[model samples]
Target: MASYDLPRRLVAEAFGTATLVATVVGSGIMATSLTADTGLALLGNTLATGAMLVVLITVLGPVSGAHFNPAVSLVFAMSRSLPKRDFGGYVLAQTVGGVAGTIAAHLMFALPLLEVSTKVRTGGAQWFSEGLATFGLVAVILAGIRFEQKAVPWLVGLYITAAYWFTASTSFANPAVALARSLTDTFSGIRPIDLFGFWLAEISGAVAALLLFTWLLQPGTSSTLSSEAKL
Candidate 1:
């Protein structure tokens, strides 16, 4: 991997996250504008978000491990793949970039730059779906990095694409993205009041994956730990 300083990595994380959230919010707006079918609009949003993940991760992975999601960063921090000192920076950049992404999307769509979302997305099922979605996401990321480093981007993009269809909450597996989405009152938005459940579930799910994969990927010999992934 290329050696980049902390500032560069933060910039990459922010930029990648901004682009990702932009794609998500922008596509949702466009889809709803063009269609009345909810499913079709969701399909459009999913495709754009998935495709952008592939592109963003492919280009920025070397710079910042393409950790556009705070949940992903948290997992890396817990697993010791990411330095403790850098974890806060990563989360800050992701959150700031995510909000900027919402503003950018709103600008393009001629909507308010910031608004409280009225979309009601809450309940036991939704929270559970968020947890399960994030668990699978972190699991895939860890396994991909361990077994196939070069395929991490594609693996993540594809996993999210599938998760979007399989999960009840449409797989808002990313905390930063979820927060950004709440700033928009569009089709992709979630109610701001519902953020706590999503955040709790996402963080818990990521930690769970880390604990499971740490053991699952451990080498047979007790003398050695599981292979360390840089990202």
Candidate 2:
């Protein structure tokens, strides 16, 4: 990978993450505090997240790939698309942005941190949801890199949107994101107790995506890949 401007990448990562977090927190608060139906709140929040994600990726991708989620970074790191030394910076910037986003969400609602709980899935459902969510997210990301390099933002947004509506866990496929989202106990909050289960499932799904992506991208490996591998 060519040298990435650390400052530029950091700024991009921070801003991208911040944008993501802000949307989650802001939308979550709205859903929790205002919406009468829990389902509506979830739908509204995720839809906003999906919209914001697409826009941010389009805007920041040119600068930092708009990897708002660490899993995207991890997959790229595995593929040697990102420098190892920069991973820490990327993660840190993302975390800061997440915190900032959560904080922004809190501030927008004028609520305490304790009130930022997100009411995420738990138990067997949480585990399975994490797996499916991660699988879907990683699949989209890897596919984008391997084939549809041009329409990544739109495709990703569509995937997330559909995942939120179709999947049981509402498709939070990111580990750092899961952790960051957990800090609050609001519409976006996941119980800290359930964190490990979700993370493990998400990791498993991401690894699966890496393997599938590798198999699909390798030439003459049609036996292991799929036509969906096309961008």
Candidate 3:
């Protein structure tokens, strides 16, 4: 809202997006580098990622409203936390920052990125898995901002960890990360062709939350998350 706040928001978005891509790519590389049995690597990455998400949300959430996902930003606007005019700015920052984050990750690892998912090769249970994973994540976030105000940031991380562990799709919830991960043809890559299917599932999940969160989640204050404000 303030003139100074816009730049701060942009910086937060950049930093947060960078952190996300770095964690995914760095962990993916480290995991791949650690021999055949990558279960431990995956576990470590999962925890680190979850923790980073919490930290990022806590630090940047207040500043940027932490709409790290474009879909999240959209839903937030629909839910009225964000101004409609600012939506385009947020989306632009997110998209550019996300792509920049991916490029940074790729450069950091010195890995080759193949145009992997360009032919619609992904199908079957993968789509469903994406849907479920995304829905679970959005549900967690909405619950936080809607009812559990103080718990929102940290819980975001924990929710991510659980999603990775329980969901078939390893819970790549943020579309920013999804696009960034596509840059690297590694354990994280979903082939350029496969991207559409996963994106469709994720978008569906976000929209579902937008439509249903008001009824499903407990009400919260306009400023603080509680049952005080009547929106």
Candidate 4:
């Protein structure tokens, strides 16, 4: 692993997360303004978010492993890929960056800077969808890192793009992203009251993926996983 200081890595995580959320919120706003068709708006948002993921991960992965999502960071920590001591910093950075991204998108669209979302996304189906979506996301990430390290960016981008449509909650598989989205009353937002279900589901999915992959990829091994194993 190429040595980089913790501060630099944290900065990269923050910057990358901010850009990712901006891409999601900004594109959703743009899509809604341009079309009345729900499917078309979703398609536009999905494409923009996916494209941004590819670019951001490619550019920032070397710096911080590009963990813009808290769920991903937690998975890495549990798998011993991310240092336990640095876990809190990663989560904090991602949370703050996510909020900043929401604010940026709101300012760009001339909307209220901190509107609470009224979009009520709840129910058992929605929770199940979130779990399924996050499960696939973590699964793909771990598998790609282990096998096709060079293609992780593209793999993640494509998986997210597909998951957006397949999942009921539009695949808010990221905890930070989901929390930030609640601050925007836009097409991609989720109600604050519904946050618990989403977070629980996402975390559960990520943990499940981590355990499964650990068993499959390195059965009976206890060595600490390297943070720069592949990313």
TM-score of each: 0.94, 0.88, 0.85, 0.93
- In the range 84-194, model 4's lDDT, one tens digit per residue, is 999999999999999999999999999999889999999999999999999999999999999999999999999999999999889999999999999999999999999
Misplaced by over 4 Å in model 4 are: 219-231
lDDT of 3 at 125: 73
Model 1 TM-score (2 dp): 0.94
TM-score winner, 3 or 4: 4
Clashes of each: 0, 11, 9, 0
The pairs that clash in candidate 1 are: none
Give per-residue CA lDDT, model 2, range 79-190, as digits (tens). Answer: 7888878888888888888887777777778877534444646878768877888887888877886788878999888898888877777888877777778888777778
Which regions of candidate 1 fall more than 4 Å away from where they truly are? 221-231
lDDT of each: 0.93, 0.80, 0.74, 0.93
User: What TM value does model 4 have?
Assistant: 0.93
lDDT of 1: 0.93
Tell me which of candidates 2 and 3 scores higher on lDDT.
2
The model with the greater TM-score, 1 or 4, is 1
Superior by lDDT: candidate 2 or candidate 4:
4
lDDT comparing candidate 4 with the true structure: 0.93
Candidate order by decreasing TM-score = 1, 4, 2, 3
